[model samples]
Target: MTTTTPTPPAPTPPAPAPPRRGRALDSASSFLRRRPRLRLGLLLSAPMLWLGLAYLGALAALFATAFWHTDSFTGQVVREWTLENFRTLFTDEVYRTITLRTIGIAALVTLIDAVLAFPMAFVMAKFCSPRAQRILVIAVMTPLWASYLVKAYSWRVMLSGNGVIDWLLAPFGLDSPGYGLLATVLTLSYLWLPYMILPIYAGLERLPASLLDAAGDLGARPWRAFRSVVLPLTFPAIVAGSIFTFSLSLGDYISVRIVGGANQMLGNVVYDNIGAANNLPFAATVATVPVVIMLGYLAAVRRTGALDNL
Candidate 1:
């Protein structure tokens, strides 16, 4: 009887109450939930303020500065507004030459990068297995981790008269192009090649294999299918990549300085004006050319529906 009398089950301990702050937090969260737009506005306010101040506001100031003239004697940015900087940019043959040369180099670099990236990207996206694709992607991206200056200097050495490239080609009676526009173009193409490859790879990877198969089935040869299906589909990616290459090259002064020898691009002009010549107004005016060019380019491509695709 004693054994059969079971001890009263111990009363279960009451659950610990939630902390007061947790309840306050829940209430706050509930408040935010009730006004999503306010929450969103609060969230966006910081970034919008930063973007306005650091970017748009700076750009507006720069545009304003471009309209002003510099005081030569004091080498100070004069607040007086004038179109003289723009008139000089337009009328000066040196500016015209530099502008054209810069454009040519940018275009050449973009063309080179696009040509080189497509085959590699296509092979990676279409032909390679997932593991192989990953390896290739890693290979393409590895160089990007290296300093841009390091790569430019490396190319400078390679293109030097007795450097790696010339040493290799010496026996073959071939020589490096040496330091000039060609060198600048090559260095830019090499630097920006990964940018070109990544976008085209993403675009090609997104393309359905069935479309390519259907093209092949419909009496299209390999080149024809690529020309009709692949190129059209990938054009937006090409444009996207070109934007990086072209804009980077357009604004680049460092690489040219490192490897360009006597050559000077638009960027050099801007730099010289800002530093050597002490002409901030002229420098700002020169800087606006690339901005205007990029804007015009975007506008032109907007009609192609490519801007949206990017």
Candidate 2:
């Protein structure tokens, strides 16, 4: 009887349900997964389009405007191509002097920033604990959070007679270097020092401590080791920082206006033409000077692989 009861077979289980087709989004994601290059291209397309339309388009318009001079009688832009602006920029002694002065200031600022930044960056990267390094980084960047005008005006006050600098130097019988070229340089150096410091800090952080120790073991003095090893390694980072400091100084007008007394840079010339003189063509022409100089500087830097560091 038991065997007969067992003879009744168990009911078959219900068949498992088939998976439904994926949604449109899932399908697209699967497709993209198979074509990584296409996915990357899609991601970059929007930014590239915006850059082309906004930045490159504006630069093109500026370059075009530079060729067209203003009608003196009408004070209106005349849409005609001419090189009179270039001719004047080259031939006029005032413009030439301004150009040279601008270059010299930019160069001096770069040199000063390099000299000051290297040691601070080395200390930050090699000596400090990680927490201290972060605190120092925040300290360096804190000034950038303040308004540009605020910083400039603060410097203006400090550079004024009997200001903080004068007070500090009073015991030494020294006066504040009043507003002028020196003030301009000092202000610009302060403004751009962070830009210089961060890059060199990054470079130094990437440097290996063993190299210094190895050099020491090889009977190299600190100065010799630094000149032969550290300097060469960090040179590209310095150049990368120089790009920021140099270009910013070259095109700076606000800082100059605040602290640069009667002295003028190429930026001042450009600002004067557009605002006071109402000469857009000449202003655009003046704008090209920095652009061209940067292009040349970049070309040279490209050779040294400094651009890669940036």
Candidate 3:
């Protein structure tokens, strides 16, 4: 009797209920579901718009034009499709020489830019005060605001057979100094210097000073600390700067045309093909090589998550 009374007295309590969805979340979910068509359309259209308007349409038109034959006698493209245009590029040793020279120059310029940019970037990051840093940044980026054509032309004058440089250095036994590859590379370097410095500098600036301090605390000297800690941390920046230098140098026809002496690059070839040879399609094809190569590198960067900050 006592146990039965106690059991009956143990009153039951109401259970808590689960929370309902908020109006905002519910509305969002509903909107997402109802707007599937719009979302899908956006997804599908973005790439088409980019490719159709930016690249494929122009490329198709250019390729179509390449089919037209270039008349060697008239130095004009005849309105007929022919393989002769493509064959001429491959057969002629002049085009081959030009292509190779362009590649070599681009490589050399990239190497020089990398080596030159790194030290400057490091100095700016590790030594300079914030005010000094700002001034230096402005100095590095100042050239970009100037006319690229004017700069190249100025370089041409500077590097001419007898230019102002020779005049300035006559007492020191130096000549117009812009005489050859040295002048071309120097001018190209000057032109694209900012592209290299900015990224590398940004990368170095991002490096944690604590890492360097920690390396030093562990008995590592400054150089060893930089090699082990700073270098790895800034690798992505170096690679990015290298890419900019390489790609820009590779496509620079103006610099080469103005001051390269006999050293022609891919850009000049493309220019020559467009006007002198009248072979737009082959030039487009040649142009596509750099695009594809750079895109592939970008893809690799994305895959590695190295471009996350950029």
Best by lDDT: 2
lDDT of 2: 0.93
- As a whole number from 0 to 100, the lDDT of residue 146 in candidate 2 is 83
Best by TM-score: 1
Instruction: Report the lDDT tens digits of candidate 3 across residue range 1-310.
Output: 5575556566776536424756677666678778999768777798889987778887767766666655668766577767665676667898777666666776788788878888998899889999999999998888888998899899888767678777788889877766466777888887777788888899889988888889999999988987889888887887777677777877888887788777677787788878877766677656655666677777877654456534
Residue by residue across 1-310, what tens digits does model 2's lDDT show?
A: 4475554466666646433564666678889999999999999899988998888999999999999999999899999999999999999999999999999999999999999999999999999999999999999888877887888899999978869999999999999999999999999999999999988998989889999999999999999999999999999999999999999999999998999998899999999999999999999999999999999999999977788778
RMSD of candidate 2 to true structure, Å: 10.6
Q: Determine which window of 10 residues in candidate 2 has minimal summed lDDT.
A: 14-23
What ranges in model 1 sit over 4 Å off? 1-18, 22-24, 303-310
Model 3 stretches with alpha carbons more than 4 Å out? 1-52, 60-91, 299-310
lDDT digits (tens) for residues 1-310 of candidate 1: 3567675567567647767869988778889999999999999999999997778999999999999988878887889989999999999999999999999999999999999999999999999999999999999889888999999999998898889999898899999989887888889999999988988898898899999999999999999999999999989888887888888999999999988989999999999998989898899999999999988988777766565545
Find the 10 residues in a row with the least total lDDT in model 3.
14-23
lDDT of each: 0.90, 0.93, 0.76
Better of 2 and 3 by lDDT: 2
In model 1, pairs of residues that clash are none
